[model samples]
Target: MATVGAGRDAGQNLCGCCDDVVGGLPTGSDLDLLREGLYGCFGGAFARELVVLSPGSIVLAGNHTDHQGGHAVACAVGSYARGIFRANGEGRIRVGGRGLPAIQLDSADLDARDGGLDDLSAMVRGMVALFLQRGLAPGDALGFDAYLALDEPVGSGLLGESALELAFAQGLNNLWAGGTLSGEELALAALRVARERLGGSSAPMWQLPVALGGIQHLSFADSGGAVAERIDFDFAQEGYNVCLVEVGDGRVTEPASCSSILQEMQAVAGALGAERLGDVREVDFMMDLPVIRDQFGDRAALRAIHFWREDRMVEHRVRALKAKDMHAFLELTRASGASTAMYLQGTPRVARSQAIMLGLAVADENLRHEGAACIHGGSPERAILAFVPDSVYELFSQGMNAIYGEGACRAYEVVDEGASAWWL
Candidate 1:
């Protein structure tokens, strides 16, 4: 329902000071990087109809808590997934992408796949299912030749899979549904796909940030639903730049190391007879600790402490962001990092990476720079996100990468726009 044009129009919403969201269009090099491997895959005909979607997400805080009905803060990032297609006129759908072979399915078989759906096929089948579930039949089938490019670091906590699913859903929905689905609807459909077929988690945390598009405070309600509130305050307004530093190369394969923590929290919640962990108070947890620990062990006690602290941290983080209190915000980041390390048991195999991250935070504070560093993602050792002043970024990046490796730090700005499409 939105439009993207080079010229300024009063009718179409513009991002910040420009007509383009996320600064501007992809740079020539950025476009070239995306197009590099797709030459032989799609000819000029298909390339001309490309529909580009918005970028992915980075969870700002409240990691590994969303699924258990806990809160989280997440935002859309600069990296994106794009697609190109035309009507195949064959009542069949085909999808092809990096490392995924091209697949074709008849429209009649949308509800029944021979062996169920993989990642790519899930997007098509999921969208079709969503349409059917809503009592709207997608008129025809169109095969897309698409490729996904992740601008974020490979092991970065950004949700590349969610980005791809959102892109595909947007493209297909636009084609079939006349783009009636809101960002939230698209995110819900993507969540269904992820849950039913792909066995992935973190839907609203990843999907809302990308779908709503921006630096947003995604508030998870007591009912386990979420609402995205656009954060109007810019980091540039406070002379700060957000950056993610790659501290390690390890990836957290699911049924991740964090599941134990989640299980422990859920068990604690059950023991308290509370519906959700967030509903269990600090007093309730502390008072019950002796009995809880006796029943669940020391790990459960420590995890309870983390759950309580993280709940408070998420609350305070929202306030800090709203107040534009960078100092308070950075302090909370350090506390979160410390809690994750000490109590939450977030070191996913490599303790050294976390140690270094904590060390950098100490150095950053000692230097009196207006910034803070913390373990970035759900996996404690993968990366660290720092809100550093633009002036100190080079010095900070150089020192961190000197130990971690070169090109380890990358900067990002929150942009306001979700999964959007423009006819190419």
Candidate 2:
């Protein structure tokens, strides 16, 4: 048998655009590291026979609005949660990766994960169990050993968890089911795992972009997060780069703190007899604010107002992108950011970081010229999403890292693919 990690061709050419999407082709050494890591985890069997999956997204517009079935513009970034898998034939599943301990569980015991649930293990088990419940298997008749590695940080609200869920979900499907699931199905399935098992805050907003891939204008209906209109969008032709600046102070923001944004929005929607804020017209919402105020108070009224305006901003931004008008899009993004800060008031945890990001957007010529930056969304996030003219991208990166520290900024190229898997 070939030694572990001996053959590198297994994952090569799996993603045709990996080089272009991953900031130019990875060097031989980079590929070597990937292979070496695979070998180190599972030896020759897993290294020689494996599958790879990538997660993709950067919300260009619409923040904390998708759960309300609102419009959102999402771009697919190159970063991935690569899951390498091979059938174990032992009816047990094993998972391992960087910063994650090797986890092994009998196929019969996956449901037992809840008793002493380690968050990550429960997540993996939950994902697998979800698939099985849907009458799908993660591999052939045999179970599998999987290894996951992410190029992005967890809990930055950059869709890292969503990416992991999609990558694993799709990878398992491809391995066991011959990739029969459609893109829409895979995306929805992953969202279900996040919502049902992980108790995630946002699913459709994050899952759709990551699962569907590419630059998309996702118009979610006022209904409860099921219906969506997907349209193609392009920003590269206009020489713009999407940069996600991780301003995290080395801590993951808790979901409990950010949960109130959606909860309050939902409460307002319920009071308005609407499923989501989007169902209430701007004029109607304003006219009804007094009635809403009496019950939910001004805080809820203001948050609901932000939702209405945020949806409008997303609609306008989508039009701007479609018209190839980058200027108007940036303006709308700035307005949306301001509204988030002032009206929504859901970013208390990252308020200081938000201030620092807004300051950079206004003061730094490199960032300010033909670019706009914001706190990413109304939900508490440690990162800011900035759209910079390609000409100033490098300078913008330098400026951000100088302030936020090196490795804080990442420039993502929107790609045309999503949650795909391949077998070797």
Pairs of residues at least 3 apart in sequence or in different chains that clash in candidate 2: none
Sliding window of 10 residues with minimal summed lDDT for model 2: 1-10
For candidate 1, lDDT tens digit of each residue in 55-156? 777778886567656677887776666554445455656665555556776666666343232456756776667777786554554444555454543333
- Model 2 / residue 246 / CA error / Å: 2.1
What are the runs in model 2 whose C-alpha is more than 4 Å off?
Answer: 1-35, 46-48, 112-118, 138-140, 222-232, 248-254, 349-366
Candidate number achieving the greatest TM-score relative to the actual structure: 2
How does each model score on lDDT? 0.65, 0.68
lDDT of 2 by residue, 193-235 (tens): 6666666656477777677677667767734354444556666
Residue pairs clashing in model 1 are 213-417
